[model samples]
Target chain A: MFSASVGLSRNWEPFDAGEEIVINTLEKLEGEPKFFLLFPTIHFEKNNGFQKLLDGVFSQLNRSTPLLGCSVAGFINPKGCYTRGVTSLAIADPDMQVTIALGKNAKKTPQKAAEEFANMIKKEKSKNNSGVLFLILPGSTLPKDIFHRTRRISNPLLSSLFDKFFPLYLALSKEGVAKESEFIDKLYSRISEKMIGISAWDNNLGFSNYQFFGNRVLQNSAVGLYLSFSGEITIKYATPLKIFSEKLRVTKKDNSNYLINEINGLNAPDLFFKELKLEKKYLTEELLRKITLGFPISAYCGNIFFNRVIGLYSDKFLGLTTALNTPEIYISTASGSSIINSFDKVTDGGEKTNFVFGVSCAVLLEEVGSKIFEVKNILEKKQIKNFLFLFGGSEHFMTEVTPISSQESSVTTFF
Target chain B: MSEETMLSVLEDLLKEEDVLAIMLARKNEISVSPPPDKFKLKNPSIFSLLQSTMNEFFVVIEKFSSQGLDKIYFELGEYELMFFLIGGDTALVSIIPALANKGLLEVEMENARLKIRELIQKGV
Candidate 1:
């Protein structure tokens, strides 16, 4: 018999309690816990419980216990959001490699982190497409170098494309997560799946018989996880929806996590916003929301819509990292339907799902209301039990190689 | 909202051949065209609709030069659907999908602004 349980918990402010939940959840998952994943939902009721929670979790993992989890946007269980703590726990082989790390601690980019995390997978390793690397980075950092994706693809292709299997993921933080239950209902999944910033279909928690999470590797809290086997990890993404204006070359770049001496061949953020017919704040808010939604929000809270991002060419803003110039910088745009269709086709009662985090459109949130979050429970009910779904807003939760300046420190890959 | 415009916009954005209707809404009522059949305004006054779209989104109100500027959505079949916005109180709101040629859309959007201005003035 497959034994599995899930622990769901939350800590409201004032009480400042995360340690108790972690202790209990870890206790439940200890001995035979195949893989333990945690999605901490703070801010909704701020209480400084996170440190306690992290401390509790750290104490439990026994130094890299093959565990993966992240902070959540909103959480769910049989009951409502009255308290914060683990709701369930389980024991079984989801067949996934898991890792945990706070955003700041993960020095290298998530892809590299995944490579390191994958080595921890004892089960198997194959020359073919083993498993996909899931990168989770902190939302606050707003992942700087996503253009590294192309590099990921090319690297894998060289020696049978190990990097190709790695897809990038961002981790959204407090502001996004606090908005979780904004709309608990009213979303039309079948239709709006094409509407980015509206919905995500990749994962289903609507409880079913089988399990998900199998055959997948997980990187929790911006910590990367890579499972090595032979099956291909198919990737579909749309970034940088609109160039907004002529693509500019980066004159000088370095990743110091601060906007220091940045020279864009163009007027920088100003020109880009002018082309979009908006202001700087709009772009920041929109992109931040997009990162939270894991997609772009065309219609603001169902108000007015625009083209969403498909992908980004980091070098376009190359000055942010390498002191070189990236000529072609384009933002991707596409409908939400195809993504949903893919999720629809791939999801199954018995299919194992590893890790999934996404952002839903604010307008969709307005449209669906509470359904935006209630879907968590619905999905939990619909998906196979094996799958571990950690949902949050758009925040790049991966470690990117930030080329430091002459005065700063250099961060090379670990392991 | 005209099916043609809605169809084109939806096709480009969601890649959907089928689009019911799009709306620009707020609390209870319509600031533009009367609420369509399936659409109903909210409980608040007229400003609610305007606030819904612009307030939190870091929106701006620009009195168009012989044009208008408003982007909002409305309700359709219990589905608050539609891409058409209520522009400039007396203006125009245009939809530009990222996929299509960016330059061309910019021009067309400008023209649409003029047309919306003329219409708003004529009250036709």
Candidate 2:
């Protein structure tokens, strides 16, 4: 359905190093690209070179084609994974129509902003009637205004009191997460027919950095790229976490899954360590990544086991990526071997020999270390040509009219 | 009590052949039992889609009050969208395949609604 070429460059001395590779990517393409999707690493963000490099590429393209990209921790391509270079995927498909929309001021009303962006593109004409909407959302926190609006407690005093005790409540509230999810939901609901592509997260640049880009404008927004394809497309995703034999019941927890005092009738943190068999001194970033990305609570739904990634951990309580909240109980454990096995399982089949784009969990790179290269080798052996991968904080995919957030998982769509 | 009741109800819904997906949303936030992975409604927009559908349907319902229509039903190709207000900002949404027995589905939904009501009344 498409032809794509990828280019990478570690030289950032002249600020044109990345652009040189980008130009080479376009030259390598069989035909004129409809659009360009750039995934540049944090190294490009140094010395304010991200924008400079973006401008350089824009100047080279001369505004002839649409450019959309996000700042990523790292990226992967047909060759291998890269941490210090720019990975540009130039897609050339005459049968596919692409629309790029940026939702400005996403920090304020992420849901609404995203809806507007999706709506704008949906209003345009799609060639094939069958396409995919690939979303790139910001990883940073929503604006405080959105949080306050979410509270909706009405009584300022009551809300303040709740906030005083649970300071992170407003920030990590399930409601806040739901709002973002709802935004993606609404977008999909508006256009249910389009196969939703893997949604990538731009490394949270906090409030200062420009998180997303469309054309030449860098802004805090959700960028939705609508690609209408005339041919066939397939998608495969792997959460890469499995439940251990032992099951742990949540004996007690707050409204959010953050403050869990006990699990399986024992201290939460103690149970976590005992079940995983880890030493306290070895709780480094590497191990933490393995746990958060590899070990996820298993929840049974239909015939599949969906793994929920853990967000934070402390001596007192354990946190989860999303608030599974009250009445949700499950067992979870992390093993590098299990994660590697799960990756192999998920990547079993359904891959096409044509164009492919994937977004892998950035944290997984820190955890599995060398296994990532093995994964690349597997893909290479599979002979997946013209493929690009983005390593980021979170990966997004939509199915059945909703967007699902996954960690330690790689989402790849084949066209 | 509330969690168990809701979870059990959802589990029951899964047994139905036509129930492609079932989810519950409270104040626009989805609290689906068995999680999104099970029903495959993991799309973040599913809640908003249901919420918006209900919101728009209610507006139409309020406008056509004279017709005495107490329920809303809609279809999208092969999927049947149905929902019942389970009281207090909560709505149970079910996406069923068109081939399913609609009558039987309604009966199951009503029974589930009653259980949810009991939980609400008991403050569980």
Candidate 3:
């Protein structure tokens, strides 16, 4: 029957405003929360000031405290939203238990390590204690090459991505170049067949809710912990809805620059512009627009799969990623209904969990918008009190949102 | 030996029938005289070629010769390929493109071989 009430007061002080924001939060949480998680909203593009803010925040935290957090797209609180921000979840679960296990940087497998840790929980703890594992994997560790076959099929201009989006890029392959313009047109017709399909998802953050916690940029790689505990863990995720009317892919890229191309003949950033049908090119194409790489996660063929706008490329036709040939992207047409549904279908549950920790995508701040209040209202309907959420990449394979589960959430070991 | 034993041995070598299928080649003379239906690899010489490519063959030299290893792993560069040996002359080989974590799989195979040896020696 405990309540989570957040008070927000934005700071306008030009110098170290971020520090004030977190300091105020610490003061509010001073009365030792049954268990409090601290997540400082980090906006590094803001660079300079972020450092002092982090140092100050870190100084205040108990080094022994397990903080389940990440680099965010934005943050949320009662104060509304912004790209540069942070937030924390304070809990009071007298019956709760949690712990965090650090994975060997790039050496050991996250799953095996987490499972070993999960098994380490005291066998004497009434054998009925259920827990979750929350993983915060490093985003840079990804597999070598799944799309090596694509190198043989080339459009010359768009062959580089043959390494990642391999299965679908075969549409533009040529038996032998026949007619020039006609063949080019035929190529576009063929490209339409090359639809984006989700390959294996790496959400083995040890808990069931592997869907939450990373960015589209964080897709190829991952990190986090497995959360195991001693009972019933509660959790869910949410995202706004929109559908694509036009689509594009970046077939060729070099760093940020991409030679964007697509199956429909739409070139460069125009495909996104046309897909959204928004006239202002400046707003849609801007680098800092905080555009959510909206993806749809649905059940297909009895397995969970994600469909989304993978990432953004530069604003050049040759570097047309933002302009053209990026991988598959979805254009939002309408909003989703379950202001609470995205978070509804969680990873399959079995172990009993009395508490959980959540690390959410920074972008959820935008997608949830004012509706975050509505989502919170929905949560108020539940009795889940021990929980924490921080803004960062969706953490796994989600385009817009990711949440670490109790199994993946990091907390000091308490059986 | 027995057809049952041969089939079991062949199945052990092939792993799965999905992609790579190991087939036995019947020697010509044997086929004509006894309908031998024998088996040999099309490219046994590839092993010789590999040995020559490396300028030396690392044969029975063992970490513990008395213990006798049930398996040995070879790392072929360029391809980073791996091949394993089991039961003396019988060899389990794989090309990189068609292989997955051969070194790791070799450990499991060795464990299985050791157990089989134990069962045989124990009259089980």
Candidate 4:
């Protein structure tokens, strides 16, 4: 029998939050939990709070309980949708095998770090074991100088112009998604198991988030949890986006292929604004956020369309949060109604779900705001009783032959 | 609470950037911030319609479930309407732009509702 429970603590004190989380979860869970998944908000990282939090957690349970987690923007559980606090899920299943692996300095050496992570999991699992992999990688890591430079620009249009003219400087400064993509590519080369996870993020787009492995708190790391289970696993996703523009071909790109310089033989940013009928000079941070939330670049992955949020933009180029493996793409838009309605269809298929673990783009949280609680309400209406839903910088899942990184939402249901 | 004090509370809620209007309704009486003429000129029937709908919806919910209705939200094209049930027969209604930061607004609304409740207890 498999048993799972989710707990959340809004206590400001880190140690208390950790203790409260364990107490709340263990009270509902049966027997000894095989694994604990922690999702702490970035607020707990202050004053070495993560370490103290871990100390409190280990005080209650076994010292060796495998725990893997990362800083998230916020989370939604049975209690409520919260922006600040710690939430955790505990699973007690004797038949399931859980293994954890962490690779450090992922930004500095992605391929090497991924190899270290993949090799650890590869050695632990037999070839015949059917399982799913959960990953938590570092969020955007724009260098200090570049981040400060961008912060100093009060006008977004000027910032866009600056990035467009000095592409090399911006390229050298940002290393989050590009490095993470490389890490995923290299890890897939070693392991063939289906993967689903998210990149850790803070409420602000500050790019400084931590990952937890056992009792250790880390940054710029890749953490993976492989669960080898004999039961069934169902993967479902919701992309609250629809095609807004006709298909356009990528005519020019940067060396990394993540930056689009020209689309349909025209300047990428110019065409983007023109197609959306947006005034370039009037662009502000709020407007940019609205565009990122409502209008994302969509491309075909397998049979379904995968959406990528715009990360960086300049007059000369458009940078996406994830690199597209295809040249054909279209702009997609989402409304408040569409976003809320899409959650109704997320768990449509017939499957007896025992527990659900969900990861959604933080952009959705920003878009919905307090309306996020309505999403939890919708899931409950679908009869999903036990679940932990988190908001992160990006969501990741694997297709049959390729790994897909998106800004939408995905759920991994265990039965 | 005096009429001036009640108006002050409603005015404070309107200070939020995206909050277009605010109304406090109890039984058949309704108090609208910025008065009814100035803001209601855009949508004359929405307020009364929403009030009636909320009451009807509450009746349906009370009949079907043991849980009390706490809040209701409606996304109407470019605008969003929210209702927060206060004590007694009173409720707070707010109209905001669709893109407003609802999470933050919810906290603000809760705070406003508490203030309104306190005022009501003191005799509004």
Which candidate number would show the highest lDDT if scored against the true structure?
Answer: 4
Residues A310-398, model 3: lDDT tens digits: 23232333221111222554444224344234433331121123333334443333344434444333333454333333444333322
Candidate 2 regions off by >4 Å? A125-128, A140-182, A193-210, A215-220, A245-271, A277-294, A300-304, A323-331, A334-352, A400-402, B1-124
Candidate 1, A1-415: lDDT as tens digits: 2344455553332123334444555564435654555554333213334444455555544543455444433333333321123333334444433332222212234333333433433234333433433333333222324321121112323322211211111122221111111111111211111111111111111110011122122222234344433333433222222222444443433333112122354543343344456554444322433431232212111211123221221212211111112333432233333333322332332225432223322122222222223434444555533333333333221122111111000011110
Q: Write the per-residue lDDT of candidate 4 for residues A1-415, one digit (tens) a residue.
A: 8899999887768898889889998999987888888898877877899998887788786777899889988888877777767899999988889888988888667788899999899888756667889999888755555653132344578656655554464345435554667789899988878888899887645457888999999888999899898855666777888899999999998656667888999998889989999988988655765675578899887777788777766666777766665799999988767777766666564225777777888777777666777877776777778878888878888746777778865544445
Candidate 3: residue A328 lDDT (0-100): 51
Query: Cα RMSD to native, each candidate?
Result: 18.8, 25.8, 25.2, 8.4
Mark the 10 consecutive residues where model 3 chain A has the least summed lDDT.
A192-201
Model 1's CAPRI class is incorrect
Candidate No. with top DockQ: 4
| Candidate 1: Cα lDDT at A205 | 13
Higher-scoring candidate on DockQ, 3 or 4: 4
TM-score of chain A of 4: 0.91
Listed models, DockQ each: 0.02, 0.01, 0.01, 0.14
Q: Give per-residue CA lDDT, model 1, range B1-124, as digits (tens).
A: 3434433332332211122222233223332322234222342233344345643332243333235433333432223322223442322332222221222122223333444444446664
Per-model TM-score versus the true fold: 0.38, 0.63, 0.39, 0.77
Chain A TM-score, cand. 3: 0.47
